[model samples]
Target: MNELQNTLRRLLRVVIGGRWGVFAWSLSGASALAVILWGLKAVAIPLLMIKTASWGIWGLGVIRESKLRTPIRP
Candidate 1:
């Protein structure tokens, strides 16, 4: 698992550490993930929605805290 993670990191570094790299990689990864999710229909849809909403809520909470001048806690 560590080896696979290392290999992916290297591959992504090479792919994303080039000209206009961030945008290119973001698009490539998002498209590939979309295709995989599309293939996994039923399960992926709910999971994606759940994950997105969780992130959205967490993000809004962070912004709210920031606006309220609250210190972030661990």
Candidate 2:
């Protein structure tokens, strides 16, 4: 089991360190996520809406905090 684990780790290091490996891995993950989201039609819609709203609220909070921290000039 330990030898198998070490071999897997070595393979991963080689794959990730090789040129184009990062892009390939990123693309693979994104494609998998896209397929999963497509399959979850009902859940994805509401989840996306909530995620977008949260981002907007977070942005507004950041803007308000920055304004409050800055001193008003004459």
Candidate 3:
């Protein structure tokens, strides 16, 4: 469980670390959104899993940081 939390925190940091990170996240988010909106059902389902995981990492990291009074540096 601790490893999972640490891994997620690291991933969240990478997501907001720099312009490259922002661009990568944006592309993934857009691609996931597009797939959910109009892509084939088969492909969209798998992409949805990935998208949910990404969002979950971000959400959990924020919540954990807040509870621990740790700064989430942008």
Candidate 4:
């Protein structure tokens, strides 16, 4: 019982902490879909642009971190 309680507590904490990122990603996808489906090309384009820019920034960060983690070949 004690072990089960500890496991549940950790799971709850992880879920709570990750909720915001999950929500934001879901909202971004949903909004983009809404714009596209509703024939709001003008609005959709800008929203997609923003999404792409964010992905680019995220990719850059990942790349930088990966490089830092790797040993230099020189």
Best by lDDT: 3
TM-score of 3: 0.37
Count clashing residue pairs in model 1.
0
Candidate 2 off by > 4 Å: 1-42
Residue-level lDDT tens digits of model 3 in 21-69: 4544675687677777877675767776766765665556555545454
Q: How large is the C-alpha RMSD of every model relative to the true structure? A: 14.0, 16.9, 11.3, 8.7
Predictions in order: lDDT: 0.53, 0.54, 0.61, 0.58
* lDDT score for residue 57 of model 1: 49
User: What TM-scores do the predictions have?
Assistant: 0.36, 0.41, 0.37, 0.39
Write down the worst ten-residue block by lDDT for model 4: 13-22
- Candidate 1: misplaced stretches above 4 Å? 1-42, 70-74
Clashing pairs in 4: none
lDDT of 4 by residue, 1-74 (tens): 99789767655544333444344456567667878777676576777776776555445545554444444687
Evaluate candidate 3 by giving its C-alpha RMSD to the native, one decimal: 11.3
Error of 4 at 65 (Å): 0.4
- For candidate 1, the per-residue lDDT at 32 reads 55
Clashes of each: 0, 0, 0, 0
